[model samples]
Target: LVAIPPSLLPCWTIHTSQWSLENTIRRRPLLQLGDNSHRHLNPSTISVTTEREEEPDFADHNTRRSEPIRVDLPKPATRASTEAGGDDFMSSDQPRVVESRPSALTSNPVHEAEDEKDHGTVERPLVGDQVRDVIRLIQCRKCSRPLQEPVTLPCGRSLCKHCLPETHTRENISYPATPNRLQGFDCPYQECGRNHAVGDCGVDVILTKAVDNFKAEMEKARETITTAEVSTHVVIQRPSAGQTGTDMDDETTSRVVKGGPLVAVYTLADSGELDYNSNVTFAEVSSLGDEATAIDNRTFSKVKESVRTEMDCQVCYALFYDPLTTVCGHTFCRSCLHRVLDHSTYCPICRRGLSVSPLLYRESCPSNEHLKTIIQTFWADAVLTRGDALAAEALNRHREFDIPIFVCTLSFPMMPTFLHVFEPRYRLMIRRALEGDRTFGMVLPQRPRTANDTHFVEYGTLLRIVNAEYFADGRSLIETTGISRFRITRHGILDGYLVGKIERVDDISIAEEEDLEANETQQALERYESAATHQSEDSSTSRPAMTTPEDLSKMPTSELLSLGVSFVERMRQQSVPWLAQRMLTIYGECPNDPALFPWWFASILPAKEYEKYKLLETRSVRERLKICCGWILEWESSSWSLSDCRIF
Candidate 1:
């Protein structure tokens, strides 16, 4: 009833003349040139101003971006709308509603939907480029062709599987997803130009099917063209005078000769309009054809349900949050695949070796982007529910304290520790850790001096896996960085490796009393430094008293850190080869930050493993630093060397 500029709003409305119920639409740009350069953008809120008491949601049906492009919608327009289906398409019953949802296509379908049947699902003929848009959605954005066995990358984009780079793919070497992130090509999408690695790629099952449908549509269109060209013939007439071919006459038509070619005859006779050339075109032909059945609300729901079934992870028997596909052409959820790989490198469904495909790279791999887009497009509510459930599950994972423990040498927070995963049980533990949160407990075995002593020390550091390189014989060399300390509440062995229910070990905050203690320690350290200078100068007096662990422990955190820093400075002055500039670059120089200095000192200190575990037992930063200072003092007093302090 009203005419207005199309650029006023961004709603894409379907024609309601064919069959009116309601249409599925989303908020998309009418004309976006590149990036944020919108042609006619006026992003201001527009709501219905009807003379009603209150309106819970003032947004019209046009601005909703809830579902995918293919949608059948609107349940019923009722004020007391309890149904989720009906809530989406409810527009105001007054004039302001039309302006609220300005259409880019035709007029607003809401008024046209008033004179309609069928429960909320509007049926409109797929006209113009709508059918082609469906085909475009599945096409490879890079190669400008239908995706051939499409592989989804972490960047939420896809290209042909054959198009993936093969430079880093090797059989027995380390995984690119582990030791380092693999270098990749520029992203196909203009919106995202960042490089995405092939090591983080997964086969796209849903897009592959869409490509097949696209192929079928092409074949059908060609057949239609061939039939149209070959199915008809032309009739000609021998004109007596300079006259063109007229209407059919029994006598005249009987004596007429057959035409050479239909096209040529049309050209010679100068036909007004050819029936074949009237209006039909290949681009205008809908992929589903004229006989395409319109889907109602119930049928639309059933279709999504069927697709959801395909999207479910077989291992978890739930909706796939991040689905991944293997080189064996099998697709499964990322976490599910992780669980399967824990036992063997073979695919669970196909029993084919998965070593050919890149392993799960949590830091880089984002699983199947196409599948993820489809899931979010179709089941926005379900995805939110799934995300919440997974988050809770991940939180419970840490809180429940059913953690895998690695019985190894001592480790400290912010310090790196390398381990050789030759033992079968520890390999499984590492796999489980990588799959989950990339963390596990690291503790030293007890000396068993007392009968009450446990198999391993109670206190340990939680190691977060940084990198791992695998061997063909099911062994791996993992580089881990310590996260935090933990104390085991209960312990037991599962499948040969230890599993523990542990509580976190954190430092006691220092107060004024500790500051006073630090001042006293500072005076004592000054006295010792003078005494050591005197002893070195004289050569007749015995060495100054060694600072025992107990004495150093009583000192404040500042004193301990100063002692360690002084020791490192003295060692560097003496030209200790490992403390050279190159070594410092590799291992990092003595950190000026007090919170980090103790761990760095602990990592490089040439103390015994048993002695190092004492650092884990303490809940005070002062005590930990004191332990490191004590080791340096002991090393100096005994004239011991740090020749065995290897970087490995």
Candidate 2:
């Protein structure tokens, strides 16, 4: 058995010895040398030797080594290098040095120098790249195009061309492109090239801003030009009083010339210079505030070159003069009111029912009429002074022709057909008509009423009274036929009745059939037979054949008249009671077409006053036939039972 010494015993027991003891000895020199120190070691100065005393049970005698020699020198001022070949100094018996502080020097000086370099060293600013990239990525906000140059906004942002100034500068400062700032430019990007403002550097920032601004300015200029070109020119027609082409001998020759009114209202800016002598009526001047200014020699030249143009009437598009308000509270020019009443009895503005007879034209209008008389008085005076020439000039502005007109007065009554009883005045009208050429012109009254007085349609047919009968009530029932459609040129009250200047419409009559034309005669005969038998329940009432010239002439008139009456009666029989009712209500006993025998018969047969009025106003014979046919067709299809039928 081997005896173990106290120090040797610790080495002999496996659990008592440190496992890192050899590793610590080998690595101890590296830690003590610091990270960058260099070491000098010679192989001859250190030697290893083996010594044998007694062999242990598990020990290899050949592997046993002598402890290396230890040397303690003053610690080096610098650390050692791993690449200095100093590994031979590390051994188990020699203690290794431990480092107390990190070394200042490092082997990676090149890498450290690179990390310390400035981040701004990149020659070009990323702002320009960012701007270009952003502009390219986003299409134009307005026109949606990528081809436009990017505008470098003062907000240090960029946008495509064609953006509005309001959109860009609402909150952010925006730089506009102009020549004033193009020479020296500042980077728009914040903190980029902070030494320069937009006009201080040479980076062409000013040029970019200028280009964008120029494009916007050009667009504004183009809009102005387009507006000027598209504006409506006022046309004034001035007629020289009493001047005719045939009256060349007259010294004070009156001529008609057309031009716009001196005052005009404009809503846009006008950049063009004003020329008073030129034909242009008015031009827009400026849009400084909410109000727009326009220039005409008469109105704007005196008021500091800018004045509010008068508000125009909504109906006439002219400065309101003598404005009148309807009961519906709608305002219109006095002249416009007159014209509207000629066409319709309703208010022009609200389309409400109106009584023209009570309409009053006065200087003071209703509260809703914004325009006062002060303005109107001045405008009216100006118009009267200037209107004659203007009207003459405007005369050629519209095509002119003489229009035939007709006028008639209502007369007589048939129950359910005509609601109105014959008044005393219309009886006088019939007596007057009988004393004349049996013809009377129909004219609409100046004012219409819903009740008590007569109202006539604007266009009425001329009437020729053919037959008359005196009734017990001192009323006269007259049969008449329509002559032609006419337009009333002028109307006036005459002898308690309406009288009018009416031009007669010349009829283009179809050629009359010769006596030898058997086919026409047979057709006429058949038409007469159809008319006579149209509504007769008794076959005995069938028309007799006409064999004489007088019969031929009279037969057509009788047949046409009978046909019109039969058509009405048939409509009433076929359950289309409305047609009979309408006819009765319109025509009454008085003939509708009092001038034409056939139309007069048609009107008297239908009891309605409105139906008579329709016949009186109907211009074309063909149209009358069409209307009659429609009624017949409607009657045939209806399910209403037939009632007592009688001719008036």
Candidate 3:
């Protein structure tokens, strides 16, 4: 895995950029103070704020007082503007009288009604609903009003200080006061909502300053920001039905009233130099940044709306849910990303091959944490509702009983199943299984004798993946071990493979310790003694049995185990072909425990696959051993020889 620096963490970075404090901020004109002469800005470290009015109470919400708020915005100047530049927006630091008109914004709001009733506050002429619709970046996300005591959250969004304690009032989440229980809540921002808790976040000093400046600038703009937004992008309001034709004498006509359309006037052109009627005024211009650096109030609101569109996940056609960014620099919801990977090991957005991504083999997150936080901070309520729906859907899936099945080979319990997945259907199955619980079922193909059988063998093993290596061609090599055997109850087809519901097959040795039935006991003893007579006549083992077949019959399991272990030791010493070095390396040394020896012997026993299949069918350990011991006695008596057991 690549080791990214802390400052560049949560994303990849380009190390070559000169990131220094010297020339970080390239300023632009904050506001135009004159309509006669245009002055281009020269971005600088030091700024000179010319206060045109002395001791002006910018926050006097009691009346419609006129105040001139001045800010110095310096930037690189164009040749025409620099040569013809007279004084700044004013002659000196003195207020200049200009024809002013009251800006239109709705005074009626949900919070305002509550504040007036509870706090006995007077209602001033605030921004109207049409203006509020276009200006939202500087307001409180929770209450949809100007921020009071703005607090910066961990998510990098600004919130009012009063919003944190209202978690209990807003949602049904209970914040228990138990000392041991962790205190936190799910994030509310819809785009990247997750769990979060209140931390030691005081009022953000920078955001407070920005908000204070905004309030002062907002009041000042009521008297000044009426002429133009930009050269072509202008803000225009339609005339009322009773108004006369273009005898435009009234300046208050520009004001948008309640229920008026918030039209964004566009005059886009393809010419190198813009052509315009000299009648309409235009905003001061500057060079835009990478995308844009300077913007008017209208531009800011439009950018916020555009960003909302980019936050949606293409796979689901909705907002991101646990978003993860790929190494290819594209982002998708984490669940959608893995679902795409199941079909093809490539990015859905760019189709970049992800076979070499370090994220696949190990469990490290490449999630868009900062993006989630910002989204959570914006639409917390909507995100909470979405999270609840997603959780319920996930719960329903877990309650279902379907499992993918690979019908290629016979797999026994507690044994390895090595696989080279080349088929497209099985590759997709393996990828999905690895991404999920790392489990799937393995069953043997139907034999010709059971030609009527449309599906695979009923009995199979559930394998858990241990390791895997993927190739560029989409094939993968994987190593897995059998977890348990299962019996298929119902089956269906998925894609090109099989999926089934199964029940686990556990060993049934609960009755093994009890005495066998009278007739069955007699039959077992006869079988052992008859085999014992041959052991005496033509035995390969040099050692004598410590107990006879008579002692073994009373406790049938232990006696059979003794018989099997001695025969295995004799054959192992004899260097039988099936017990060769390769076989030992693959399956490991023979197990000594009676409960385990049956599976080991059945694996390497040079018998037909159908005979070996019986081991999986029987649940009792004693029955499985009888099948193994019978094979050994038969192989010993006859001059039997064969090649190694077939794995494929």
lDDT of 2 by residue, 471-560 (tens): 678665444444444545444454445554343332211110111222234445566556556654743233223333233432333243
Off by over 4 Å in 3: 1-401, 448-452, 509-555, 641-648
TM-score of each: 0.36, 0.22, 0.35
Screening candidate 1 with a backbone cut-off below 3 angstroms (N, C-alpha, C), the clashing residue pairs are none
lDDT of 1 by residue, 1-648 (tens): 011111221121112232221232221222211111211112122121111122212121113434444433333232221222121122232112211221221222322331231212334433322332333444555554556888766555677887665444221111112322333455666665544444445576655764554355344433443434222132323334434334343113211112112112222222222221111112212343322223212233333344444655666665666666664445776656755654355776768655422335533334566666565555443344344344434343332234778776788887766676887778877777665667778887777776766768878988777656566898776666777787877665666667766666655422212333445564465554555455554332233244566666444454456567777877777786657664454347898666588777766654566777777777555556666777776677564544643211
Residue 6 miss distance in model 3 (angstroms): 48
The model with the greatest lDDT is 1
Error (Å) of candidate 2 at residue 519 is: 23
Candidate that scores best on TM-score: 1
Ranking by lDDT: 1, 3, 2
- Which stretch of 10 consecutive residues in model 3 shows the poorest summed lDDT? 269-278
Clashes of each: 0, 80, 14
